[model samples]
Target: MSVAKKLASQTAVYGVSSIVGRVLTYLLVPIYTGAFAAAEYGVVTGLYAYVSFLNVVFTYGMETTYFRFANRLGTDRRELYDRVLSLLLVSTAGLTALLMLLARPLLGLLEIPPGHEQYAVWVALILGLDALTAIPFARLRLENKARKFATIKLVGIVANVALNLFFIVLCPAVASGKWLPALQPLVTHLYDPTVGVGYVFLSNLFASALTLLLLWRELLDFRFRLNLAVLRPLLGYAYPLMLMGLAGMVNETLDRILLPKWLPDNFYPGQSSLTAVGIYGACYKLSIFMSLVIQAFRYAAEPFFFAQSTEKNSPATFAMILKWFTLCCAIIFVGISLNVEDFGQLFLRRPEYLQGLVVVPILLLANLFLGVYYNLSVWFKLTDRTYYGTYIGAGGAVLTIVLNFLLIPLLGYLGCAIATLACYFTMAILCWRLGERHFPVPYPALRLGLWLLLASGLVGLGWWVQLDGWWARHAWHAGLTVAFLVALYVVERPRTAAPLVVR
Candidate 1:
């Protein structure tokens, strides 16, 4: 099979796992909105934003490190595995303890009330468990064990979703004497309706713990070797990736973090700023259409690019891949933007949560740029100039934070979306500029720009112009979507990429 075909097959398999798991887990959004108020949901969003940063912290870019070292690139696979596993075990334990100890101070840093201490501790535990498993998961990726990887991931998602239902839905029903009278008091103690978002955290904690248990095979299959010599170089390589990961998290999640504080309390008067956050968080899920696609692509692309780094004409290959990826992302952006309103059956159980839907298109576009940036990022990763990634990501993160600070007070959550779009756009541009100097990929910037503008304009037109009839308006927008797809085929059909064989 051709390399591109292999990549597609891998992406599809990974997508089945990630996209399916995400879709299943995604279904819980409505259940959550139904169970919790906007403010409660907002608090959940804020805590998870902090968790995203901590995940970056505890994992410390070891996934990328493992991939870089354990593969054909840097070190003996078994030796690299043991080195990373040993480091992770020590670090995970240390960080988990420290985070729990500093939970209150950490929450204070996040501008969260210290009363949310238990939540902070839970976040600490989740990140540590997840960090512990990072190298194991990367091992699966390196060995081309995509199916096994997907199974484990899907299993975790299933467990989390099941626990969520039991805690939020079934337990509530049982406690209320609506389903199981025998289990009423027990469930009443276990399930706190007013505790609201805590259940979401609890469910995740249990699921993560279970996943660690399931990963015992990878953890225990080989004896962990303590090689300080191997450790020093690995750290040297990974530290930059850690910085890049942290900065990337800020770019991706700072908006959710800042939205709560900067969005005024007056918007919902009696409620805290979390109400706006809840609305924004729920609306952001709409952009997961693009995020899921980007994630699945990354799952395949990261390994693909690493393996391909030694291949002949790889730059051209990366360039071709970027074009297709960009086109795919543009399709997703258009798909979500056109269907944002009608996707109500799949989104927002509470009508009040729909207030922030306008952010959907902006975020979809933002994620498109993010996907492109990821593709462009291959230059630094392959060249061992990962510090460049840190520079790029840090710049984007700073821009995201500053823009959110300035705009949130003025425009509410809309400002957050705008900031995100601008941040990713700037990052993509910078990555392209720097990448050209080091590992030039002949990415079709003009074509990509035209497609994005065309799709955005079509969607934007539909959004701005309120057609009188639902059927007529949707049909018109739907036609525009078809036109976009048709145009994509017409432009690219005649130009077939040569079968890629680098090894």
Candidate 2:
């Protein structure tokens, strides 16, 4: 099969689980918003933000390291795997244990309330589990075991969704004599009514534990060998990747972490900064569709791109792939932006969260830029010019931090959204500039820009037409989406069909 076809197949397979899993995860947003106060949800948000940062630390870019060494013609795959897996096990286990030992001090440093230290501990454990699982997941990609990878991922997501339903919905309803009267006491005891935001972390920890059990095959396949000779070069390649990953994480998540701190003392009268953070975090979930696409593409694209790097026309192929990727993502951006009001209602179960709906389009577009950046970034990775990535990512991280600091205090969550867009845009442009110098790919820059411009205009037109109510808004957005589709078809149909007609 052609490389493009292979990638498309892999992306579809990965997307089945990723897209479904994210949709399932979206169910929890409503549950949390309904069951907990916004401030309480903020605690969940802050803790998870910390987990994102810690995950980068614990994994230390070993997943990419595995990919790099595994692809080398002369490397001993088993030894490389063993060495990497052994390093991960030792590092993550030690980190988890150390955190457990210093839980109290760590909690204090994170500004966790005295009563919420256990939440911090649970988050640390979850992060540790996730870090350990990263290597196995990477191995799945390395070996082209997409079926097993998707199955394991889907199972975990299903298990998580089931557990969430049991705890948050079914358990409560059963306890209240709405579902199962006989199991009331058991349900009530198991489902703490006052736990509120803590259950979000607890559900995640339980899910992680279950996922670890499901990864038994990949975990046991490891053969512990510390090959220092292989390790030396792998570490050199991976160190900058680690820096890039850290900076990327900061760019992606620092707004969640810093927004609370950057909030003015009296911004919300009686409510705390954490409260504001929770609202932003919950609203951010609306953009997970963009994240889902980016993730699925990454899963398939990394190995595919690396494998194709030696092909004669790989650079041209990459440029074409990136152009297509941006066009697709821009279309999705318009679709989502046009219908965010209805989509926001899916997760914002309570009235208070409706305020955050304003930021959804901004966050969605930011993620779209992020996806485009990822597609453009293969140039650096394939050319072994990874230092450019580190440079661009570090620059973006600085912008993220500065923007959040300046804007979060003044504009609240909207500022964070704008900052995210600016950060990703800067990274994409910087990477493209550096990449053109190192390995010029003739990306259809003008055509891609025009597509985005057209989509933006369509969405803008849709926004201006006041579709009176929910159903009307839905109809209008659907029509607008169709309009975008028709426009794309009109522009590309001749090129797409000419070859087929000739054949």
lDDT of 2 by residue, 325-399 (tens): 777887888888898877778778887788887787778778877888888888777666678788988999999
TM-score of each: 0.95, 0.94
lDDT of 2: 0.82
Model 1: runs farther than 4 Å from truth? 72-74, 109-115, 185-194, 268-271, 497-503
Off by over 4 Å in 2: 109-111, 464-476, 497-503
Worst 10 residues of 2 by lDDT: 494-503
Per-model CA lDDT versus the true structure:
0.85, 0.82
Give the Å shift of residue 319 in candidate 2: 1.6
Over the stretch 1-503, how does candidate 1's per-residue lDDT look in tens digits? 97888999999989998899999989999998898888788878888888888888887877887777765544678877887889888888999999899888867755666467888888888988888888888888888899988888989999999999998899888977889799987886777776667888888999898888888899888686777785897788888999999999898888887776677768656656777888888888888889999998898889888988988978888878888888888888888788888775567998888777888999999999999999999999889999999999999999999999899888988999999999999999999999989987777787778888998898888788777887988888888889989998877777764422222
The CA-based lDDT of model 1 is what? Answer: 0.85
